[model samples]
Target: MTRRWTHGRSMRHSGAACGATSAQARITDEAHLVTCPDCPDAAEAEAIPDDATTGDPHLIETLRDARDGHTRKIDGVVVDATTAHAILTVYDAATPKTKAKIAVLPLTVMTSLAWNILRADVKREGPR
Candidate 1:
């Protein structure tokens, strides 16, 4: 005897009860397979609560405070104090072109200048 199959019954036989609204059905020698391109994979689908916080204001504020509190130092000398003072002093005394050049000095050279200034090796003369 032969049996006739309907579309819904065939979908049920394929073991895909998730619904066939946007699914593609394929028949293989071993079994029938139904795959939906829009559906997320079973292992990757995670349930998130409606009240879950995507971005916490308190966490953002804490991170900003931590970043602000961070003090950058090179060889035990503070970059903001010694290096900044020397740069500002020179910038104030420099011509417009020279001031522009001083603005782009790399961090390594700036730190070296700071080290020299702290050691009294770099001398500051009267404004020219």
Candidate 2:
């Protein structure tokens, strides 16, 4: 028996009930996923797991540490995958001209980090 159609549910749920995927379903508001039980579970089931961190304990540990409110670190230096990903996502979605402006961000970040480290070392050495 078909589940009776409801007003607030996503088209994805409606599609599922009717046994067809809808492109319209793909574009529906994300909030529906939160309020609609079946769609949320199906969406969770359909989500692709990040494979890079899946088997690597070190990467998993870093992500866990980040999620737990500690800044992520690799080789004892603070780094943030989340921020890096946000930057990359913007770059990827940018127009060509915008991409040109964004392309140097990683290098700029590295240069700033290096300069800060140098300044800290000079301060630690204390007038030598």
TM-score of each: 0.29, 0.23
Q: What does candidate 2's lDDT look like per residue over 1-128, in tens digits? A: 42223222233245453233555544344444344455554444334233223224344344445545665443323445654444444545668896565444343453354455556767999995
Candidate lDDT (C-alpha), each: 0.38, 0.44
Per-residue C-alpha lDDT of model 1 across residues 49-97, encoded as one tens digit per residue: 1211223323222222323553333222223443455555555666889
Which runs in model 1 stand beyond 4 Å of their true positions?
Answer: 1-78, 111-128
Model 2 TM-score (2 dp): 0.23
The most accurate candidate by lDDT is: 2
42, model 1: CA deviation in Å?
A: 43
C-alpha lDDT of residue 51 in model 1: 19
Candidate 2 wrongly placed segments (more than 4 Å): 1-77, 106-128
Q: Could you give me the TM-score of model 1 versus the true structure?
A: 0.29
Error of 1 at 52 (Å): 34
